[model samples]
Target: MPEPPRPEQPSDDKVLRGLVGAGPSQLSTHAALRARDASQPTDEDLAEAERDLVLVRRRYVPTQNLPPGIKPAN
Candidate 1:
């Protein structure tokens, strides 16, 4: 049997430019987000976030509560 066709990939130069060609403002925003993510969260903050997530998961929202055009999973 014949193999399926593969999608065309971007050239290395194109990929390189895409990563390196961001404007100063975009680069600064990216750097700030990276710095924030690199910082470790405190134990108290982690605990509170975990508690909040548990509460959110425990609260049942019926399918009817979902916005229009959004279907529930099978």
Candidate 2:
């Protein structure tokens, strides 16, 4: 049998929006993975992480995308 085509991944903006909407615990884990791991992430991982951070900051509070701030105006 032929293999099925893989589904497309969500765009970075969409992913980050979901992450920001996910709230604190999720954000903490994401921050920890990106921050605690001193080892360099691959180009893709690094880019994703950077995008996550930027989106999180903008969408949430100034204090590490925690809460109590305005999300993107969409």
Candidate 3:
């Protein structure tokens, strides 16, 4: 059997808008990851937090597509 084609990745803006419980200034999963792991990362703690955040977000949040009950905001 052949595999079905995957849908395209949504724009970063759309992803941010669709994020549940996200604040307007809050960074996206990837952004947070960069923040925490970067040399500065506002020091270091935030970088570690951001790295952990990436893991958590990848597991729970939608990346290229969303799971049920996680529809994108218009």
Candidate 4:
């Protein structure tokens, strides 16, 4: 039998927002569900997500230049 049509890949902006610290929007979450159902996510998608995640994590972390005994400000 002929193969089914593959689902469309997510836009770079959507993937970046979803993977990073930003919470997923309803539309992006729905798109991800569709992609998962269709098994259409590509390696580039995964790599981009990983890259964005690292960047997001670094952005939120406190700077390391504080004095040894200094605690984070409330």
**Tens-digit per-residue lDDT, 1-74, candidate 4:** 99999998988876657656455554566776786777765899899887655332433546665446555544
- Which candidate do you rate higher for lDDT, 3 or 4? 4
What are the per-residue Cα lDDT tens digits for candidate 2 across 1-74?
99999999978787667556665544567675775475666899978887666453334435344345645543
- Stronger candidate by lDDT (2 vs 4): 4
Instruction: Determine which window of 10 residues in candidate 2 has minimal summed lDDT.
Output: 56-65
Model 3 vs. true fold: TM: 0.21
Judge candidate 1 against the unseen true structure and give its global Cα lDDT, from 0 to 1: 0.63
User: Against the true structure, what is each candidate's TM-score?
Assistant: 0.25, 0.27, 0.21, 0.24
Two-way TM-score contest, 2 vs 3, winner: 2
Candidate 3 Cα RMSD (Å) = 21.0
**lDDT values, one for every candidate:** 0.63, 0.62, 0.60, 0.64
* Candidate number with the higher TM-score (3 or 4): 4
Ranking by lDDT: 4, 1, 2, 3
**What lDDT score is found at residue 27 in candidate 2?**
53
- Candidate RMSDs in Å, in order, are 15.9, 13.8, 21.0, 13.0
Shift in Å, residue 32, candidate 3 = 10
Model 1 stretches with alpha carbons more than 4 Å out: 1-22, 25-34, 54-74
Could you say which candidate leads in TM-score? 2
lDDT of 1 by residue, 34-58 (tens): 7568777989989989766433334
